[model samples]
Target: MYLGIDIGTSGVKAAVIDEQDRSVAEAAAPLAVSRPRPQWAEQRPQDWWRAVELTLDALAADSPAAMAAVKAIGLSGQMLGVTLLDRADRPLRPALLWNDGRAGAECRELERRFHDFTERVGCRPMPGFPAPKLLWLARHEPAALDRACRVLLAKDYVRLCLTGEAASDRADSSATLLMDTAGGDWDDALLAACGIARTMMPRLVDSAEIAGIVRAELAARWRLPAGTPVAGGGGDNMCAGIGVGAVRSGDAYIGLGTSGVYFVANDRFIPSRFAGMHTHRHAVAALYCQQAVVLSAGASLAWVGGLLRAPDLSSLMAEVEAAELIPAETPVFTPYLGGERTPHDDPTLTATFSGLTHETSPLALVQAVMEGVAMALADGHEALIESGARVGEVRLTGGGARSTLWARLVAAALGIPLRLQPHAQTGPALGAARLARQSVGGPLIAASGSEAIIVPVEPSLREQLLQKRALFRRHLHLSR
Candidate 1:
């Protein structure tokens, strides 16, 4: 058996899979993101470790035999987080997360400092990247910066605690705005621009390579086999790609987690310096992936649900789905709740609801929120296309993908067929397990049992949505 763990922004998940790639046990633990200040997202590094331990304990209780039979482990997590560590690998402070915008000024400063920043990093230096976070710390918290001796990404920190090693993979490291992506190494020039040094970065490794062995104490505590090799997995997006079997050129999928991502694989590294899409090494060897990210997906729905005091999103969604599909004179929503990415790349933007009337019902609000997220993803799809990604069909995955109404809306908005792959609800955890399988020289698992559903668009509805999109753009421009 192989064990895989994914440390997500909102939760930690673990799955145990057999040699045949079937999951035998699964567990998860919730996490909370603290917005201590505007545009600042923080999470305790030790909280992540505790969550992982809790998840493992749950898995052990559920399937002790599988946990004990685990031969190897793999990891995946949210990308671009900066986890500062002092000497002896202790966290200096709460991790600066990917969605945090406190480093916006730092991003602009780095852009001004480095002429070839985009070319080397494969994407614009948004506030989400780790390089800017380092610079922000250097400017705002010099004391902590001075004491910090090493930097690690979210999953890398977890790996360090697991195996007593500080290392990272190409996919996660490339997104840091500190990597020479094409060269697959930390770029000295870019590091200098951020006022960071090579020694601060973790040792780089391939995603599926064995980075370290599980420490004896950790293994014994978790009921895992001692000395099990732990694979250098990948970021959540890349691992989800592997989970869904999007390893080859032309393979694509739309992830609908807290953040929506339109991901496409490439046989070679193809970086677009001008476009907003991100190009990073695929977790699979000798391949690359391009992704267009939407900062809010299911988040919008959750926000609206809370505003209406609904118990959960499902009830609101059910009401929306059952409501009549009118001729699109409803409230228009722009889902910029956590700001925008992909084509826009604007961190200061905020969500807005326009065109609400006295006649607007709770159902209309829910529908508008769902449609807003779909429209945002459609914009992301366009951005990916502009980056030269040749998408055929989108395999939709994540919590939002489970909503039939939202899936239909996304499919109609993108004007493409979407396949709902089996076991997609597991998301990154299963992908990590798959990587663990591959790290041990297991055979590649083909994408199987996916049901493709094509939602046809109505001409009238398309025209109405187009008008709404134009209105959205105009409102966005005015808001800026």
Candidate 2:
């Protein structure tokens, strides 16, 4: 058995898989993000470690035999977080998350300081990237910056607790804007520009390589063998690509989790001139991935559901699906509850609902939010194409993929077929387990036998969504 753990923005998940790649057991624990100040999102590093332990304990209780049989472990997590640590490996403060948008000014300053910033980093500096977050810390919290001895991403902090090692994979490091993406190593000049030292960064490795071994005591506590190797896994996006078999160039997938991502793989680095489109190293060596992000995808739906006091997201979406709503007549929603990334790169943007009438019902409001997310993803798709990235039929992975109605909307909005692969919601965790298997001499990028359900474009719905998209863009422009 191989084990995989994913430290997501919303929760931490642990999965166990057999040698045949079949899932043996899985468990998850919830995590909350603290938005203490406006435009800032933070999570305690210790909270992540506690959550990991909770998940592992649950797995051990249910599948002790499988846990004991675990050969190797792998990790995947949210990328670009800034976790500052002191000399004793204690967190200096709450880690800044990827969706935090408080460093817009720092992003612009970094670009001004480095003329070749985009080319060197493989994309423009954004507020969500770690380098800009470090610059922000240097300006506003100089004491914390000065006292910091190490900086780690979200998953690496958990790894430190598991193995007593400060290490990360190049796929996660490349997104930090502190690494030379094409070189697959840390860039000293960029570190200096952000007031960070080379020694502050963690040692980097390939995603499928063994970075460290689990502590013997902890392994025993978790029912694993002594000195089990831990693989250097990747950022959630890259691992999701691996889960869906999108390792080769031109392979594409759309992720619809807390954030929406349109990912396409390439053999070489191809930085986007378009703002907010990310180009980073793939989990697989010698490969790269281009991504367009919608900062709020499932997040937007969750927000509305909470406002309406809905029982759950699944039931709320069911209500929307049952209602007979016209596409063009619904309110146009700009899902910038936090901010936007792809095509806009505007951290100042906020969510807006236009064309709301007295006749608008709860069902209409929910439908509008769903359509709004699809339209935003459509904008991302167009941006990727404009940047000369070829996107074909995309495999849909994430929580939203379970909703056939939403899948149809996304497919019609993008005007491309979407394949709903088996075990889509488990993409990142499964991918991490796959990497763990590879670390222990398993197959590389192996194909699955399960077939996918395809959602094809509806021409009539596509035309209607296009009209709604035009209105959506107008509202976005007006809000700006």
Strongest candidate by TM-score: 2
How high is the lDDT of residue 86 in model 2? 98
Q: What is the C-alpha RMSD of each candidate to the true structure, in Å?
A: 1.8, 1.1
Q: For model 1, what is the alpha-carbon lDDT of residue 339?
A: 72
Q: What lDDT score belongs to each candidate, Candidate 1 first?
A: 0.83, 0.90
Residue pairs in candidate 2 whose N, alpha carbon or C atoms collide under 3 angstroms: none
Local accuracy of candidate 1 as per-residue lDDT tens digits, 35-58: 998778899999999999899989
C-alpha positional error of residue 34 in candidate 1 after TM-score superposition, expressed in Å? 1.0
Q: Estimate each model's TM-score.
A: 0.96, 0.98
Error of 1 at 472 (Å): 2.2
Off by over 4 Å in 1: 324-329, 446-464
> Where does candidate 2 stray beyond 4 Å?
none
TM-score of model number 2: 0.98
